[model samples]
Target: MRLTHSCIITNEVKKLSEFYEKVLQIKAETSGDEYAEFPTDCGILSIFSFSLQESLAKGSSLPGSNRNLILEFNVANVDDEYMRLEKLGVEFVKPLTTQPWGNRSFYFQDPDGNMLNFYTKVK
Candidate 1:
């Protein structure tokens, strides 16, 4: 089986969509105010409206309640991406640091407090 995409259920679709666009540096293809998608070479990252999701799968999920999952992005340069996000006023949960496994990365939070990591494999 292959992974296609991951969706974030959010109460503020537009707000979160805008935030992702700024962070990813790509425009989201939106479906009304209910859904938005940022397509990438790896897969599509999507945002779904809470109301719509509730209607489809009632009481299955909660908005802004993510604590254990960290959405990760593979970048060309962790340092460059860190500086760019820093200037955009993105709040960092952890500073850029090299992992013992040979990955250089940084952690930050989305508007809904969802943790996100951007990393580059170091040789």
Candidate 2:
């Protein structure tokens, strides 16, 4: 099956959604108070409140949370993207560097502690 969206659950959907908008320049739509979504070319990046998800799922505990998940955004130039994003006060884990996998990448953290990587394949 094809994936249409990726979700992030947080206490502050507005704050988290604004992060993507102000930082990555994503346009997000808020559905009432609980949900907001960014319609990216890859898929929709969404955020929702824990209380809302709980109400729908009938008591599902939150995940422990790990760094294993990364939201990778493809860019034409990794270093250029890094400079632009860093100027906006983004915290980066790694600067522009070519990985063994043949991709130049820059890693950073989102407001919700989500790891994000902007990269480009090196030919």
Candidate 3:
């Protein structure tokens, strides 16, 4: 089955949504203050309020406890993107570097400490 979207559960929906909007350069379609989504070429990146998640499925998921998952995005130029994000004062977990797999990439974290990666394939 094809994946449709990935959702991040957070207590601060507005804050996290705004962060993603700035990083991705896309406006989110929000549902009140409980949910927001950024539609991308691959799929939708969504944020759900912890309250909303509890109401829907109690204790099914935890907010701001992501330690193993890294959301990766493919960009045209990783260096340019890194520079732009740096100017915005984004919290970077790792600086821009070339991977052993021949990808130029960098890692950063959201306000909720969710890890994200932007990378470009070396030609």
User: Tens-digit lDDT track for model 1 on 1-123?
Assistant: 888898999999999999999999999999899999999888999999999998999999899999999989999989999999999999899999999999999999999889999999999
Candidate 2: stretches off by over 4 Å? 58-64
lDDT of 2: 0.84
Cα lDDT for residue 40, candidate 3: 92
TM-score for each model: 0.98, 0.90, 0.98
Q: Candidate 2, residue 49: CA error in Å? A: 1.0
Give a tens-digit lDDT track for model 3, residues 65-91.
999999999999999999999999997
Please give the lDDT score at residue 82 for candidate 3: 94
Instruction: Report how far residue 14 has shifted in candidate 3, in Å.
Output: 0.3
lDDT per model vs. reference: 0.95, 0.84, 0.95
User: Model 3: runs farther than 4 Å from truth?
Assistant: none
**TM-score for candidate 1:** 0.98
